[model samples]
Target: MIKASADALVLGAGPGALAIAAALSSENLKVEVLANSDPHEPWPYTYGIWGEEVDDLGLAHLLEHRWKNTVSFFGEGADNPSSKSNIPTPHNRDYGLFDKNKLQHHWLSQCELAKVQWHKGLAQKLDINETESRVTTEEGKTITARLVVDATGYDPVFLKSSESGPVAVQTCYGIVAKFNKPPIAENQFILMDYRCDHLSEKEKSEPPTFLYAMDMGEGSFFLEETSLGLAPPVSIETLRTRLELRLANKDIRITKLEHEELGLFLPMNLPIPDLKQPVLGFGGAAGMVHPASGYMVGGMLRRAPGLAKAIAKKIRDSEASPAQIAQCGWAELWPEDLIRKQALYKFGLEKLMRFSEPQLREFFKGFFDLPSSQWYGFLTNTLTIKELVSAMWKMFVKAPWSVRIGLMGMQGREIKLLWEFMKPKIKN
Candidate 1:
C-alpha cells in the first residue's frame, strides 16, 4: 500500500534536502527524505564546503580531504596571486573539500542515527491540493505530506524536455574531472588563468572553458566554470575532445578515473518555477546561489539549519509554507553591448577581493533571516552607471570578455558608485 501521509515530504536527497531532513528530524518532526541516489563518490560538483560550516553542523570530522591555503592565477596582464587569503581553510577563505562520497556517507550515518525516514526512488510528479499533497514516483509508488518541498533544484534542460519545472536563473555549463598526477598546488586553488582566455582562435573555436581546481592531496578535481557561448558536453566523447588539449595532454597522466558533467542555460528556467501541489521550493530551486560567484554549497550548508527550523515552526503554528526559499537569482547574459555585464564584472572582481570573512558571515546570515538580502547588497541600482562607463572604456582596450560580462551584472541593478565608494570619500 502507498504511504498515506507525512508531516513533511522532502524530494531529492542532495545536500540541501539532507540538511533539511537532519534539521526537521532534530525537532522531532516526522520527516521523510526521498532520495533517488547515494551522494557519495565523485559527482558533477566538487562540494567546497565553507570553513566554519562544518564545525557549525558538527561535520568537521567528515572532511576527508582538505588543504589550508590557496593562490589564484590570472592571465598575462594580471599579477600572479600573492595572498593565500582566498584559500579554503579553517579561517579566511578556508573551505574544506568533501570527498563527496565520504561526506555523504558521514551525513547518511548521522541521519540514520537520527532515525529520519528514507524512501528511495525518482520523483515523477506531484499533485498539490487545498488541504493535502501527493507525489507519484516512476516506480508506481506515491507519498503524501502536509508540506512538500521540491528539492530537485533548477533543471533548464529538464524543463524544456517536458514543459515543466521552473526556469533557471542564469546561463552556464560545468564539469568535474580528475588529474592523472597529484595536483600542482598543495595548499591553494587555481582560478581561471590566461590559459583559457588567451586561447587562439582555433582553440576558441573548440569551446571556451574556465577552470577551478583543488589538490585532493593525491588527486584533484578540475572544475570547469560555466561561461558564455558554450554548453556542457552532451556526450563523453565530446567532453574528452574539449578537455583533451588542456587536461589530457602529453604531460598529464591519469591513474584513477571519475567524472561528473552538467550544462545549464541558467537564464532558461527559474524565478519561481510553478509548484505542483502546495510544494515549497528549496536550495538553488529557491535562488540560493551566490551572485558574484556560483558557489552553491557554501550558502546551502549555511541555510539548512534555518530551513529545517522554518518547516518545524510552520507545522507547529499551522503555517502553509513555513520555510521561504524565495527566488532572488538575477542573471542574464553579460550583454555584449549593454553597459551592464562588463561593469558588474569589474565591480565583482573588486568586491570578491573586498569582502571580509565576518562581513560575509553577516551578509549571508541576513539573507537567511530575510530573503531580500539575496537581492539587496549586490543586486541594486548603482551597478548600472558603472556598466555604462565600462562599456565606454572598452573602445580602447580588448579585455577578456568574461571580465566585462562579470562587471555589469555583478550587482543586478544599476551601480552608480561602485568605484566612487571603494575608497573613503575625500573630506572637503
Candidate 2:
C-alpha cells in the first residue's frame, strides 16, 4: 500500500458523499473526499430527500418550496388506445428535488470550514491491507484509511459486486426534454404513468421507464424518463410519440428543446451480492435506495447519520462488536423483500387501473397512510408473535393476498438478518 493515509477514504464526489462527509465531520472526524471525476463537472442528480432531513440538517433555507403535495401517475398509462380518459394516479409522499451542484457547493463550504480533506483524483482500485485499505488513483497516488467508501456511482469503486458475481440489477434508461412553458406545477408531480395508455403495443417488460418532470423556475419544465425497471426500453421515436400524445391529451406543447435523455436507475436487490470481506459498503453501494422507488436521497440522509454514530461509538469503545454487524442497517435489511415490494408496487399500479378514478384515489389514500402504523409492526417480518396468531385467527382479512405476501416477505427478511446477527462474528 502506498504511503498517504487518512481516517476514511471516500471514493466518489456524489451527493451522498457530501452527506457522508457532513455526518462524519459532525463527530469531529476528518474525512477525505475523492472526486472520481473532474471537480468542475456538473452533478446530474435532481436530488430529492425527505422533508424532516432538510430541517434536521439545517439546510431548509437552501431548499426550494416546490414540494408540499406530490401525485404520481401509476397504472398502465399507455394501455388505453384512447387515453383521453387516462388521468394519472395521484400518490402522495414527502419528497423534494434540488439542484445538485448548489447543494454540493454548500456542503463543500461547510467541509472546508470543518477541515475535511477534499482529494481531487479518481480511485483506480482498492486493496485492503492488514487492518487498513489503500486506494490508488490514476496518477498512481495512493491513500490508506481504516475504511473505504465506494460512492463511485455505477463504476463499482471497490465495494461493488461484479456482474458475474452477485450484482443483482441495474434498472434505468436515459431521457432529456425541456419545457416550452412551466407545464408542471409546484408541489404537483407529473411523472410517467408507466401503466398509462401511451406506451407502444410492442413496449413490453424489458427496459423499465421512470418518468421525470421537474419544473425549474422560469417557463421551463424538465420532462424525461429518469429511470425504468424490468420494462422494455423505448426508442427516441417511441418516447417522442408518447410525449407528443401526452401533451396533446393535456392540450400542452413546448417549442424549446434543451439537453435530453438524462438517466436515472432504480436501485437493485436480491441474492446477496458478493462484496469483498469486512470493508464497509457505503451509500447506494449498501442498497440504501429503496428497490420499490429510486428515491434514495432521503433514505441515505436518514440512515447515514445513524451509521456515523455507530462508527463513533466503535472508536470510543475501541472495539467492533457483533452488535456492530447487526447495526449494518442496509446490509441486514435490503436483500429480503426488495424484489417482492418492487413487483407489488407495479402490481398496485395495475390494480389502480382496474378501478374507477374515485376508487383509485381511495385506494392510494389508504395505502400510503397505512404504512405509518405498519412501519413499526412491519419492522420485523411475520409480525410479532401476537399479530401473527391474530392474523391467522382473523383469516388474514386486512388486505389482499398479494400485500400480505409482500409484507411477510419483508418481515421474514428482517428476521433473517436478526438471525444472521446471532451467528458467529467474522473477526475484523
- Candidate 2 residues 1-428, lDDT tens each? 23335556666777677777777667666678787565446776556654555666666666653555555554444446457344554534444566566677766776677788877887786776444567788989877766566666544565544333222343333333445444566536554444434444454333434355655545556666433333332345545555565566556766776555434444343222343344565566554554334455655666667777666555344243323432342343343344334333333323332333234333343444444334223222224434533433342345455544443443223443334334422222
Give the total clashing residue pairs for model 1. 41
Q: Top TM-score: which candidate number?
A: 2
- Most accurate candidate by lDDT: 2
**How much is the lDDT of residue 325 in candidate 2?**
30
Q: How many clashing residue pairs are found in candidate 2?
A: 28
**How high is the lDDT of residue 338 in model 1?**
18
Model 1 worst lDDT window (10 residues): 325-334
Off by over 4 Å in 2: 1-4, 50-58, 74-95, 160-187, 191-195, 199-211, 231-241, 248-251, 270-276, 316-428
Q: Which digits, one per residue and each the tens of the lDDT, describe model 1 over residues 1-428?
A: 22336777777677666666666677677778776875442445556655555666676776765555643433222123334322222222455777677766655666677776778888887665544567787897888776666666654211112123222233333444465654445655553322432334565555334445666544545554443221222333443454444454335655555554554443321223332213565655554444345555655565666666655666664434322211111111111221233333334434333333233323323322322222222332223545434433542133334433433344422253243334312211
lDDT agreement with native, every candidate: 0.47, 0.51
- Model 2 worst lDDT window (10 residues): 373-382
